[model samples]
Target: MKTDSLVFWWRSLALLLAMGLLALVLQPFFGGTIALATMLVGVLGLLAYHLRNLHRLGRWLNDPGPETVPESYGAWEAAYGQLYRLVRSQGKSQRMLSAALDRFVAAGEAMPEGVVVLDSQDRIEWCNPKSMQHLGLDRKKDLGQHIAYLVRLPAFQQYLTAQDYSQPAILRNLAGGDSVLSVQLVPFDSTRKLLLTRDITQLERVQTVHRDFVANVSHELRTPLTVVGGFLETLLDLPDMDPASRESQLKLMFEQTGRMQRLVEDLLALSRLENGIEIREDRVDVRSLAQVLATEAGGLSKGRHTLRIELQEGAGGVRGNYDELHSAFGNLVSNAVRYTPDGGEIRLKWRVEDGCGAFSVEDSGLGIEAQHIPRLTERFYRVDRGRSRSTGGTGLGLAIVKHIAQRHQARLDISSEPGKGSCFCIRFPTNRLLEPEELVTSGQ
Candidate 1:
């Protein structure tokens, strides 16, 4: 068969031939029976040698390691050497394959999305940690379990049965709590599949918010547009209408247009604030700014309410965009003026508390409920829609204030009790506060 085998057999045959020749010589010297006995002994010795080598080979095969290769003489040596080389090569190849498999597993573990490998029968073969979290699967307990049984959503089951994986399936409120998952089945090979899942909860929230915002904007604009359009149509129809009636209609139209204009301006301001525009780091004079806001509040109140301004001595300035801070402060003061009843007191204060500069607008108004305070900064959120519209509020003021506070690395703290009054404060961090001495030095 093999060259090594052939060499071994040839050597055995030569030895036998040599023994036969010796037997012939012995037959002449001794008797025929003695020569035959000598030949039989030679054959038995050869058999014993071969049996010993075979036993060694068998032992080595049972546990073949680098250091466990059996030593041999003649043709057996060559055979053992070949086997040793083959075992070492196979060991090297197996180590490389194991390393590659480990790297692939590590990569899957590091991914943010979930990954589940399924067998031909849709049974769980393996899954990464993220997949376990997304799908609520346990590696030890859930291995070999069918995917459909674990994810019991009817839509997912339908998608699986349909076998048309062209588009991904969406599951909302998965695990019963506002979690959205996008599940997709991919057939990677003939007998297995890849079940990929991505958590799109935040994405879904953003889309919902976007839809609500568009609808709200449309609703807000539609009323004023309808009013203006109606009045225009009436005026066009009544070409020879009385001057007094014409004047009244025009005034109403003008007010509606003004309201629309304010809404658009507030919408634009909110967009600019949310779009991450670069802010100017101006050292704003809070004392002078408070005085200006007081004056403006007095004008807005128009003797209907009492106004008070309190400034902390040596409170100095805050470092931020002056325009944004002014707008935020103005919004708080204006809202106070609008909501506070006649004879109600409105106080504007600039002070330092806990090593941080703080500006607060305290108002004696119809205070907000505790639940409404958390979402007060959401765009177009109103506590009383009718009163908010009547008071000329765009409903985006607090949202603007929030973005401004965030830009300046500040916190907006709101505290209010029903019928007691509301206090809205923007607290600047210690780093953003310029003390009196620092301001004076900078001025010098």
Candidate 2:
């Protein structure tokens, strides 16, 4: 190519000089030409040189292959080199930009929250896969579609057109149903927007539960507080009232206070259980536990009901935290005593079935309805609120029992018919049950 460029320049100069000299030398032989002819030949030479360079530049523009480019000599050489450098620099810049854009897209795809790119008109340009899951959108198919048209949520439509977007907007039913999304839009350069959406369904549910729990706790505390406050005011005002009347009022106040204390205790116990306290799995003597519960139940009943205790013969006790089992068994017995009518029969039984241990309290009481049975173990749930309050029940006994049973890998089974009876039982897994011979051998 260099040789070609040199040849091209050499030919132009040689041809122009040859024409000029020939014309001047033949002035006498041929028709005499003027000095202006030589000057005209010089101008023709410059035109020829420019045409050569233009031809080479045209070829490069057409193909621009990896072959060597012509190396121009003299004045035009510097200009040619500078142009090549500019072309190469622009190519490098383009490749680097492409790579950076790919990386940016990958990062957006991996994000937990949804990301969407939109034109100034809120037309979808690009979206990440997370956005598909969050907004139930088809990334490929939904491209170029108006976001407002696809979302169709009133809150989202309002947020999209709102001039100020300093804060996020909560959009319910974003993916339909109860789904909730926290969506925010950031405008860039007044012509494009970046939309971020996060699925806040689970978080919202937790917040709701917290609110309900707070409200329920407040309500539970209010009643006893009102009772105690009223009774105290009466006692303070009546300095010379009847002694028996005063005694009754004070006694009622004491009972209400005691009820509140029991409630607080149960609440604390439930909190500990919910927070996942580890329980010791030592072997528990079911027979002895049942016997102790029977004694407590009899006392609570005051012989108003027939109480029976039965422990299966030649069966080893279950394995669990001793205090937890004791408390659970005691609660069952107490619930029976509390709910059963006077002269009603209550039976407490501990038995081993299929290598599993079970403790059941069967009571001939006003039994729970089928629908209420499912929520019996829910904290503060009650079959009959009036009866529960009358019996000094805190409504947390069954909840506590459930937590204990679950911690020990057991299941509480209930069978009841309203006006007939209710049976509350806990079934311990086979792993927790020990045979009598194994019990003696293990010395537990």
Candidate 3:
């Protein structure tokens, strides 16, 4: 009972005592039997009232529906009001807990990584949408199914049964596809665990690129350094060397140093492009730019390859950084010159197709195989390392071209056969191309 109920009960007891004392005092004026009757009547009335309130309280405890608490006087009223307040408080707490649970679920669903809840039996209980994407699982269909049976990967089955989730397991080429998932288990409760999966294909690719970059850079620098060091040792130890021999040695050393310098410059250029250089909104004339690049290619080729420039007025202009676009176009033209044979033909063209500007460099050289075409843009990747060195390439030309094209929202389409020829084209979207009037106003 409540404080108010206790106080009301005490007050009623005091009133009953005063009535009994009055009845006892009235025994002298009236008879003893009359006084006893009066006391008995008053005591019975008090008992009846208390019994009625007790019944109301018992009924409320039994049913406890949405109806208001029944009316009563004194202690019963206090009891009813307190019960209602307690019920409302508990309802508010329950609602708050439910809201918190909902927010937690929402947050889990919004996560990029896949989340799965599994029972102790390695059965799927719940999974987020990302899990569906990463694991190729249907939430409704896969639920209650054993995870090992559904996954069907031997390594994954082993991982699940191991029960030692200290580290994540790498699942490569899962779902008979090219996806890489890093999976780890969190034993959150005694009977269940949380399975987490992250699609790490892109991360793995980046790591591979980083490793290859390091190895390639070391190899490239080692070659030139070795050559230069050998030549310097020859000059230093052989003081009586002939002047002609010394001159030849020095010339070779200079060439090696130049090669190393070119390699470093290309590496730095590629790094800048990858790290995001500022793209200017200047108007770039495809025809004029191609002409300049072709001229530069002629110098680089030194008449080793026959070069031709074809300007077909592709949307007149493109909007981008002039120097960057020039560098990209220059790299493509120079690559063609270096890769093509002495008497081979290289055609440079700029034209519009489907309202998009396309710049192409076609070379009648040792064309790439179809399998090697996909990774041609990877930095330092070479189909023929020896041929690349002989052709005086830094092995980053196409990579640089790819980055610049991407920066300008362009796509590089490469078509090549083993012996026929290879055509490399950078196609700019229509928005990146400027019409005649726009080009004129843009001062191209």
TM-score for each of the candidates: 0.90, 0.72, 0.80
**Residue 271, model 3: Cα distance from true site in angstroms:** 1.9
For TM-score, candidate 2 versus 3, the one ahead is 3
Compared with the true structure, all predictions reach lDDT values of 0.91, 0.84, 0.86
> Over all chains combined, what TM-score does candidate 2 have?
0.72
For candidate 2, what is the lDDT?
A: 0.84
Question: Native-vs-model 1 lDDT?
Answer: 0.91
Give the candidate number with the greatest TM-score: 1
Across 220-289, the per-residue lDDT of candidate 3 in tens digits comes to 9899899999999988999999999999999999989999999999988988998885766788877777
Q: Looking at model 3, which ten-residue stretch has the lowest summed lDDT?
A: 435-444
Worst 10 residues of 2 by lDDT: 435-444
What TM-score would candidate 1 get against the native? 0.90
Mark the 10 consecutive residues where model 1 has the least summed lDDT.
Answer: 435-444
Candidate 3: residue 444 Cα off by (Å): 9.9
Error of 3 at 59 (Å): 3.2
